[model samples]
Target: MKNFNIRSLMIFILFFSLKISAQNSYINQYKTIATELSQEFGIPTVVILSIAYMETGGGTSSACKVLNNHFGMTGRNNVNSSRFKNFTDSKASYRAFCEWVSKRKFYEKLKGSQDHNDWFVAIASSGYSTKPVEWKQKLNLVMKKIGL
Candidate 1:
């Protein structure tokens, strides 16, 4: 029993540490862009980062890598019929994501909302995703995982 308990503890610690490391790596990579966007757009930094993390699959998805679309945005760079917008770089992708939000009139009401909950509602109600409740729940979980 003692040996079994020790092994279980070790495994638990290993998984816990890995999860923390992965979360930290994600923050290190994307926090800057999220912070900048938050400051510019009045959206909470945590909200932006959480949403991006959920959408882009921790910034490792092919959609984000190849299309530069962190927000899963669909549409051409200039053509409406295009399926997704592609950017030259991640920075452009971030900018485009912010721009897309800014263009929405409903987003104007979201400006200056400090509460992450409100941001979640704004995102869902704005038709940002087909599964609004699930989307909000996932984003909230990401926020918690990131220590936001």
Candidate 2:
């Protein structure tokens, strides 16, 4: 019993450390992407991350698995409509999202304006209509929670 307890304790500690490390990696990734997106699109990094988190559960969801897409991107890119895969790797998805925003093409055309407050609603409207209102609220709430 004593040996078992010690082994369990060590295992718990190892898992705890791994969890913290994973979180740190995620934060670092978000920070890097946010910096790039902020520079390119003039949107707040936290807001961008909030959108990503909501769309792909911070890179743990299946939509991200098949889509390589973080922003709930629809349809295809570079491939025929039929051949297009649904997933984009986490990093690539974020990069693609940022590029789409920065260029004012594709997804950019979907937005009515660049106004911060209007963003959530605009995106929410674009196919996100069903979840638009809730996502907007959540996105705004996340921005507040993160001090963004």
Top candidate on lDDT is: 1
Question: In model 2, where do residues sit more than 4 Å from their true spots?
Answer: 1-25, 77-88, 102-116, 144-148
Residue 88 C-alpha lDDT in model 1: 75
TM-score of 1: 0.82
Model 2 pairs whose backbones collide = 66-86, 66-87, 67-86, 67-87, 67-88, 68-87, 68-88, 68-89, 69-88
lDDT of 2 by residue, 49-72 (tens): 778766766566656555566677
Clashes of each: 0, 9
4-65: candidate 1 lDDT, tens digit per residue:
99999999999999978877887788789878988998877887778778888787777777
> Which pairs in model 1 have colliding backbones?
none
